[model samples]
Target: MEPADAVTPVDPVARIEAGPEGPQIGVFFDLDGTLVDGFTATAHAGDRIRRRQARIGEVTGVIEAAMRYRLGRVNFAKLLERAAGYLRGESLADLDAVGERLFQERVQSRMYPVMHEIVLAHQRRGHTVVMSSSALTIHAEPVAKFLEIDHVLCNQFEVDAEGRLTGRIARPVIWGKRKAAAVQEFCGRHGIALQTSYFYADGNEDIALMSLVGHPRPVNPRRELAAMAAARGWPVLRVENPGKGNHGGLRGVLK
Candidate 1:
C-alpha cells in the first residue's frame, strides 16, 4: 500500500504561545511512566491484540525489532518497514476512535499526582509545556488535551487515500535519539532556546533527551536511570503515593 500524505501542519498559534519573557522557559515531559504511573498506552494496544479487536501485534513486533535495532542488534530500516507494513489497510477513522476510547478507559486514570502538579506548575510559570512519547500521536492527543500541554511529539500512523491506515509512519518513529531530534526541530521552528529548557524523563533510554535540556530531572526513575542520575548528580524525584507527604527531593527539584 502507498503511504498516506503527511498530516496538514497544525497552526503554530494553536500549538504554542509566546511567553512574557519570550520563551525563556520550556518544559518537555516524557509521557509514559513519567507523567502517568503503573500503566502505559502501549499496554492498552496489547490488550486490544489479545481481544482480537486489532492486529496490533504486527506493530508491536515491529516496535520490538526497532528497539533491538536501537541496541545495535538489527537493521533499522528493515524493522521500520516491517512495522509499517502492519497498518496497510486499517480504517483511519475507526482506528482513531478505538484509540481514543482505549486512552480514556485504560490510560487516563493512571496519571501520577506529582507529575500533574509539575505540569500545572509549568503552566502557571508561563512556560511552554510539551509532551513527547513513543506512542502514536493519536493516542497521546487526548491526554495532551486533558493536560492542556502546549504541544506533543509522538509517532503518527500514515493513512491511505480513503482515510485508511497504510500501516506506515508519516515520520520516523519518535524514540531514543529521534526524540531529541524532534525536540530540536520544535525548538528551532519555535525560536525556543534549548539550553533554557527543562526535561523530565524516567528511563536511561531517554538520556539523549535529558542531555539536550539545560535542566534535566529524573522522575519516578527506573533502577538503571536512577543510578545514572545519581552518578550524574541530576535531581531525582519520586511521585508521592496517596497519603504520603511529598518526599524524595521533589520539593527542592521543583523549586
Candidate 2:
C-alpha cells in the first residue's frame, strides 16, 4: 500500500512561530558591505562634521589613517583609536542622535533587500541572528533594532560618568581575528555549536570567522574574499545595486 502524503502548512506567521526542536544554530552577519552598503553612517557623519567646520585636523588625520589602513599599512585597531580621538569629549547622546539621522538618510536606503529576506528566513527557522561588525554602538544599534536582530556583536567606545566619549574603546576592537574570537566567545556562552553555525560576510578581514563557521556565504564580496570563496567552492551572493539599474535582483557567482 502507498503511504499518504504529508502536507506542510504555508502560513508565514505559523512558520515563524514554530520554533525548531533541535539545538538552535547561530547566524552571524557582517554589517558593512555585507548587510548594508559600506560604511554609510560614517560617511554621513563625516559630511555633517565637515559642514560644521569642526575638528578639521582630526578629520584630516582620520582620513590619512583610513587611507593607510585600507592599504594595509597601519594596524586597524590603531586606526580606530585615532578615529575615536575625533569623538573625544563629544556627547554620547549627541553621537547617537547624529547616527540616527545618518541611518535614516544614508544607511537605511542602501540595505540590501535580498539580505533582509535571508535574515527573515533564518529567523523563521528559529536561528539566532547576530549583527556583527566593527561599527560603533551608535551606528550599529539603530540598524540592529530596525532589523529586529536577536543580538549585536560590535565595538563600543568608552564613555565618562556624564556620558561623554573618552576616546577609547570599551572592548578590544572587533575586527579581523578579533571578530572571530568574539563569535567563538559568544558561541561558548550561548551553547551554540560552531560546526552548525552560519556566517555571511563580504570583506577579506572576515575570513577568520568565515573559516570557523560550518556555512560561509559571501555577499557582494571584495577581491580577496571572492577568490577564497571561489577556490573553496562556496556560494557567492551579489545583491543588486539599487541605484545602478539593478533593482531587487540577485546573482550567484562561483557557486
Candidate 3:
C-alpha cells in the first residue's frame, strides 16, 4: 500500500488509534534527532575520546574524515569506513557492551518524553513498531531494546571470524534511499502495508521513506523536511533537546 493521495490535518495519535491495527500496520521512528535529542555518532565519538580508545593520529584521521563528509568531499559510507578503521581488531562483543553502557550513561536521559507517549500509543493498538535508524548497530540496538521496538533496520559492521570488525560495513548503508529500500524489503517480507503504516523522522533525507508511508510525522524536522511537510500538508512535530532549558521541550503543528 502507499500514502494517501489526499493529505489533511489530523491528530497523529488519534489517527493511529482510530486507523488499522494488527501486524500489517508499521509504526517506524528514527532514532537520533527524532526519538532522542542528539546524534548517537557524536556521543560515541565523545566516549571514545574520553576513554582514549584511539591513538592521536587515528582520532585526527576520523575527525578529518568527518569534516570531509560534512564538506561533501566524502560520502557517509567512506566516513564510517575511515572511523571503523580505528577499531579494526576490536571485538563486536566488547563494542556491544560498550554501546549498552554508553546509552545508559549518555543517551538515556536525552529521549523526548512526548515521543515515549507516541510510541506507547502505537504499542497499545498492537501495531508493529520498528526503529529505522542510520546509526550503527552498536548505537541503534540499545535504544531499540530500551524502547521494546520489535524490529531494527540499521548499519552493521563487517566482522572477521573472531567477531572483530573488518573495518567496513557488512551490508548497504542505512541512509536516504537505501534506508527506504531496506524498510520496503522488510515490509514486503513481513506482509506489512506501507499505506497502513506511520513513520516519524527528522532528517531531510528521510523524505524518501516518508513519502511512501501513509502517516508521515516529521518530528523536530530539519529545514528542508519542514518545508516539504508544509508543502505536502503533512503534520510537523518538534521536541526540543531535554534538560537544556530553553533548548528543551517539544512543540509542533499537527495541521
- Which candidate achieves the best TM-score against the true structure? 3
Candidate 2 C-alpha error for residue 243, in Å = 2.3
Model 1: residues with Cα > 4 Å off, grouped in runs: 1-22, 54-84, 240-255
Error of 1 at 195 (Å): 1.7
lDDT of each: 0.69, 0.77, 0.84
lDDT by residue for model 2 (154-226), tens: 9888999999999988878899999999999999988998777778899999988988887677788899998
Top model number, lDDT: 3
- Write the number of the candidate with greater TM-score, choosing between 1 and 2: 2
Greater-TM-score candidate between 2 and 3: 3
- Candidate 1 lDDT, tens digit per residue, 86-132? 65787777767776787787776667665676677678667878998
Q: Is candidate 1 or candidate 3 better by lDDT?
A: 3
Q: Write the per-residue lDDT of candidate 3 for residues 1-255, one digit (tens) a residue.
A: 223333344455665677667888988899999888878877788888888876899878988887897778998888878888888889999999999998999888888877887898899999889999988999999989998987999989899999999988867888999999999999999899998788999998899999999878889788889888878877777676786775444464466
lDDT of 1: 0.69
> Rank order by lDDT, top first?
3, 2, 1
Q: Find the 10 residues in a row with the least total lDDT in model 2.
A: 1-10
Name model 3 segments beyond 4 Å from true.
1-11, 245-249
Instruction: Give the clash total for candidate 3.
Output: 1
